[model samples]
Target: MADTASQLMLGSGLTVVSHPLMYVKMLVQVGHEPLPPTLGRNLFGRQVYQLPGLFAYAKHIISIDGKMGLFKGLTPRLCAGAVGTVVHGKVLQCYQNQNQLEELGSDQKENSSSLDHVIKETTQEMVARSAATLITHPFHVITLRCMVQFIGRETKYNGVFGSIVTIYKEEGVLGFFAGLIPRLLGDIISLWICNTVAYFINTYALENGAVSEMKSYSQAVTGFLASMLTYPFVLVSNLMAVNNCGLAGGSLPYAPAYTSWTDCWRQLSLEGNTTRGNSLFFRKVPAGKSYVYAQKRFY
Candidate 1:
């Protein structure tokens, strides 16, 4: 609990510091001097990069406590990046919807949505998009980190900071974003396929009165199906981010530490987890030991 407080403090403090930095960057782009990225600090960033130097450090800080600290920091950054992810997903879905409506010969000049279909589809799409976004946002960060290590020539130390630095040095901005095209392409498919499927499935369940309100059972099923359906994108995205060249593009730079999704899944799977399938409820099973069992289901 104390650690949670500290993590929160760290996150909140970083937020405060980052806001000013963002403002300053904006000012500089608007023709202001904007303070140099390196301010009055000891020596320079070379100390940050020096080999066999105490000054050099691992990209990620590991704690005896494990994921709590890292997750604390990631929560804020993940939320920021999600803004981009959602926009990308939504814009693609919009274009797709447009194309479908055109193919149906419902030119907006005559009639686009049949008013009722518009409202029904709109409601369904919004719910699926929201649910899908939550799962993707978290996994996106986890996978991105894995990619950094995969692409590395020398780990230097495990973590994102070192990897980011290496990427900047090697690829410049363009190279840093090498995998973006594939990701955007995947988004096109995810939005069109996943959204439409989820909407129809959920709509059927609701009309049949399968359950009250959206629940984890449905969400988990949706997440799994969407994940499996988009397996190709998942592979390509990881390849580009970690290897810089994916299967269709070039030979991958590194073999992923994980051989298969099932292998990675088992490694990450929490044993005795009743909550394995459910995201909202997880608690210790009432044994002598603390367990990962679902507060609602076994993990």
Candidate 2:
């Protein structure tokens, strides 16, 4: 009981610790929407490379108001974190109890193999996570909206209650569930990959005794691998969600509203291929880039 309580406390604390960093990440990821430079290039024969001026951008974001800006959308995140922790704990406890019952039952022991047991456990965890995600997804949307709501930026969403009300009025209930498909798919895949890799590493360490002091390093590496594998999907999903709200609030520079996931993919791919850069994302936006690339959509 004490150990369980300690684990819960640690998880809650870790969730809290992650918020400040998450806010910073959101700030950077959504803050800059580069416009194409005009008359400068024809280098690769297409528009590309719009720099946000890293030092200048940083300076702007770190000013007195900007420092506080780091915590812009923290309220809903903390609330969601608290609720999610409680739900996670309860779901885990339920699964543990069920497994214990299966272990104790003689007939069940004969019916299920180790593989079956593992599969069942994985399924249970995935379902639990999905449920929690659905319940808390609206909070996430609110968080993103609030985070991206800059001082001079035009946004209808304000405080938590105001945002909720605005979304309801403008977008209806479904607005809260924007990007549901990609978000769920990305989360499930990432969770599965992260846990599987972490499990293997942990088991190997326990068996071989090769890693002692480097456990934390090993875990960090595993986390990095998982994040890298899933980051593109997560990034796309977040942009989609942001765009959904943008559709409600009006035009946004980061991502215009996509009709569907396929449309989003098409737009991203076009940008990648048609743009002069080798990478999908351009650092500098040329003045003519938007007009040249986006003019077709106007029709």
Candidate 3:
């Protein structure tokens, strides 16, 4: 119980700090269009069209909005994250208890192998994350919408309560769960990949004393790699959720309905030239220096 409590508090704090990075990444990726005016043309006055490069655009955001601008949608994101952490813990516990009960009743329990335990734990994690995603999904939509709105865009949704009320009024209850399927899919893949890789590292890479000391490092690496691998799915989910911010009282059109994950991927891939559409899954440079440069450029 103490460990879980500590984990929850730590997770919430880390998420609060980290959420803005995600917000900025999503905003830039989705807002890629009519290149920033400064970069739209070269010295010759001919249109030197280019897809928004990650670093240049990030610099632009910092320049125009100042430091605080990066954290535009933080409140709702923190709310969802804090509550989501609790929900994840409780749901995981419930599933674990159910699994224990099943093991007690079944004769196979006495003969259960390591592989069986691994599979059971993985299943519990999947269900817990899926349930948590569904419950907290509305907050995610609101956060994304809030983050994407810029100086010229509509700010129909104000704070958390205002956003919820507006979304309910404008788009109905279903609007709250706009990108649920893709989000859930991404969550599941991320959880599985991270857990499996971490477990493998824990088992194979560390000995008794070293294991305790290096556990955090191993887990961090696992998470980074997992996120990178599953980010494309997350990008698609974000597009589905935020493009449909129109449903939540914004100007962007609702993303076209996707009949299946493959269909969605196919459509998103074909819509823009390969580099522009697929750039969301990768980053060319860090934003810190860009933010400083941006501040200097605009302020």
| TM-score to true structure, per model | 0.36, 0.70, 0.70
lDDT of 1 by residue, 1-299 (tens): 46445554665567555532332222111111111111122243221211111111111222222323223224334443454345535555675787578768964443332445544454555544544444444334333443232222223323445545655576565545544544545555655555455556666656546544554466567667666565445444444444322221122212334444344334333333212212211211224432222222211
Number of the top lDDT candidate: 3
Candidate 2 minimal-lDDT segment of 10 residues:
273-282
* Every candidate's lDDT: 0.39, 0.62, 0.67
Per-residue lDDT tens digits for candidate 2, residues 1-299, read 67556765776687666655564455445434333223333347674444433344444556645656556677777666666766776788888898788778855463332445546766788888887788888888888777666533655667789888988998899888876777788788877776566556755655446555555676688777776676656655665567756532223555566787557657765765222221222345534556456434321
Candidate 3 wrongly placed segments (more than 4 Å):
1-5, 33-59, 98-113, 193-225, 247-264, 271-299
lDDT of 3: 0.67
Of 2 and 3, the candidate ranking higher by lDDT: 3
What is the alpha-carbon lDDT of model 2 when measured against the actual structure? 0.62
lDDT of 2 at 55: 40
The segments of candidate 2 whose C-alpha lies over 4 angstroms from its true place after superposition are 1-17, 31-58, 64-66, 107-118, 198-220, 244-252, 273-299
State the RMSD for candidate 2: 6.8
lDDT of 3 by residue, 1-299 (tens): 78677876887788777765675566655643323223355445554433355555556677877778777888888778777788889998887788789879988754332545666677888887787788889999888888777634567768999999998998799888877887788788887887777777877778867877887898799888887777768877776676545532223332455555466568767754112234532332222335344334323
Show model 1 residue runs off by greater than 4 Å. 1-165, 202-220, 244-253, 256-299
Per lDDT, what order, best first?
Answer: 3, 2, 1
Rank by TM-score (best first)? 2, 3, 1
State residue 111's C-alpha deviation in candidate 2, in Å.
15
